[model samples]
Target: MFWSRKEKEHSSKKGEDFSEVIERIKSGDKKLRERFINDYRPFILGCVSKHMNRFIDIENCEEFSIGLMAFDEAISSYNSIKGGHFLSFAELVINRRLINHRKKEIKNSKVIPFSYFGGENEQIIENSISEKSIYLHYDRFEMREEIMIYNEKLEMFGITMNDLVKKSPKHKDSKELMVGIAKIIADNDNLYNKLISKKTLPMSDLIAFVTVNPKTVEKNRKYIIAVCLALKSDLEIIKGFIRKF
Candidate 1:
């Protein structure tokens, strides 16, 4: 499967000389289609395997089938004069197809079970736990409780639960902001717990204490920070009880 420098150069020259094959394909040549598949099988398989590993849960034969189909599609539609290496162009098409395939599977199908072919078992366990049913059940319950407690605390500062829940962060910035908020709460346990135990505060009053204004709270900076602090306090309390044993 290894190519020497001379062989690599020869392959490149042959690929470049595929201009006629490309034109015939555009004109709908059936045999040239088979030739294209024969020539690019190895390269396409390697590229698909490297990129599509993240999405597919199939064996080597299944992956190869997908890769070959992607290669055939690439050859039929590719134009060499677009200014890059043909293999590179083909790789892009294959990768995109693989990613789209994964997205469709995630959205439409159930979790794939792990079958042992002699590798690490941990990944299988982890993937199993991330199943949609388990995740949705836990996430919905936890998020609802968190929202309720957060509203209760915001009441002391005069903020309504409805306004706070409506102030969710956009997708990209949520995780980092939540982590920072967690650290802040960890550093201030008593205050964090006190806030969580309260009932009603004006939205404006709560925002003023945690942020420069109500708008900042709406932007999620204040809410994330408050959540992080409360989570940290809870963690510490749990750890303290564990230590008593």
Candidate 2:
């Protein structure tokens, strides 16, 4: 259920008034402890169920047990004055423990295919199902065609997509750097109109005129230079073209 901000505020206020309940539990009041569990059982169970998909062999019983334990732990240790409602605080504790439990399960379990449907005798069937699932999701033929087109474009630029992805964020800050250079070129009225009118320009002309840092220019020069080179124009020729505007 979605909780409105106002409803949350009301619930929080109610939780704050439960300070006496918290004290009673902390002081070993058994009846108050049971009452707390009875009231909050559904809430705790809901939290556990939400995260149940993360665990293998998890059942209603297991979820209920984990939720109750989490509830008890929250009750025994919660400090109301720390802030927020008791339910909110308790929910956080329950969810965290449940997540920890799932993480432990993942660490200890073998990586079995999700499609594995039967016992030991169904290993071959499981492998066949897994292979089919991969092939269906990852269209191999279309992927290769796209890769070929990307590589052909990259070849004109003297770099590869692999090289770009491997570069650090500090290594010229790719997209941001290109945008800044574009802005600089657009700031000059003549060049701005030409770019707007033609919708294209030599990459080297744009970069050399706009970029301030020679070092960054040199380091990232290959990408822009490749585009200019692909247009079959020399760097000096491209620079001279930009100088006219």
Candidate 3:
């Protein structure tokens, strides 16, 4: 949504390989390199904004600077023959750098601001956990980062965050039922593998393990897959949230 139609058309022109463009940049084309980065500035900002799940104030945001650096790093490190789109690799790098930045911020935020109370014999803020506000901030950051990763995984299965909101079961009992179904898939190696590889519910196979109506599974397909993916992933924060049900 950030990129313009003209730029979109330009990028989509047949036979244009960005790897070759990177090669040109590496071959000492300073102007081309600058032009490329300029052209992709919107993309860099878009990535940062999407990661933060809010519109970025580019001039004031550290994440935008980090995103640009990550894009440059991706340009330097990408291996086209390794088999993935250049932008996909760039997004991965951007997310990694942003998450790392969040972690460093969390660490820095733990440092006590008051130095007057400290002496060799006096008690300082010995544990950062004393700062409840900072600890909660770090927790929120972790959850946001986890959700970003989950969003990417959902895209792979043709599910969006919006889809989750719309398709989630309304009743508590139905929600519990869905989680139960997801756990069945997550706990079974063969069923989980089938869901991952096929990018869809193995409904027929899933039905064999549950007594739920086939129509219920069909209606809540996206939510079921999402829950199953969360259980399969190392997303402790999301798993914790899911445990409420």
Q: Each model's TM-score?
A: 0.40, 0.38, 0.52
- Give the number of colliding residue pairs in candidate 3: 0
Write down the TM-score for model 3: 0.52
For this target, which candidate reaches the highest lDDT against the unseen true structure?
Answer: 3
| Cα lDDT listed for each candidate | 0.51, 0.51, 0.77
> How many pairs in model 2 have backbone atoms within 3 A of each other, for residues 3 or more apart or on separate chains, i.e. clashes?
0
Model 2, which residues run further than 4 Å from truth?
1-16, 53-60, 112-245
Comparing 1 and 2 on TM-score, the stronger one: 1
Clashes of each: 14, 0, 0
lDDT of 2 by residue, 1-245 (tens): 33346534644564245676678679988876786687677677676655443333435466567778888988876754322346655665665565555445444652334432235445444443334443333334324433443444345345676665544235335645644554464454554445434434434455557645655555554443333322222123333433443
Q: Give the per-residue lDDT digits (tens) of candidate 3, residues 1-245.
A: 43446646767786445877788777887777677778889989988887776678888988899999999888887764333357766776787788677666657665533321234423445443445564565467666766766786788789999999999999999999999999999899889888887889998898889999999899999999999888876567789878898
Candidate of highest TM-score: 3
Candidate 3 — worst ten consecutive residues by lDDT sum? 113-122
lDDT of 2 at 124: 48
Question: Where in model 3 is the C-alpha error above 4 Å?
Answer: 1-130
TM-score of 2: 0.38
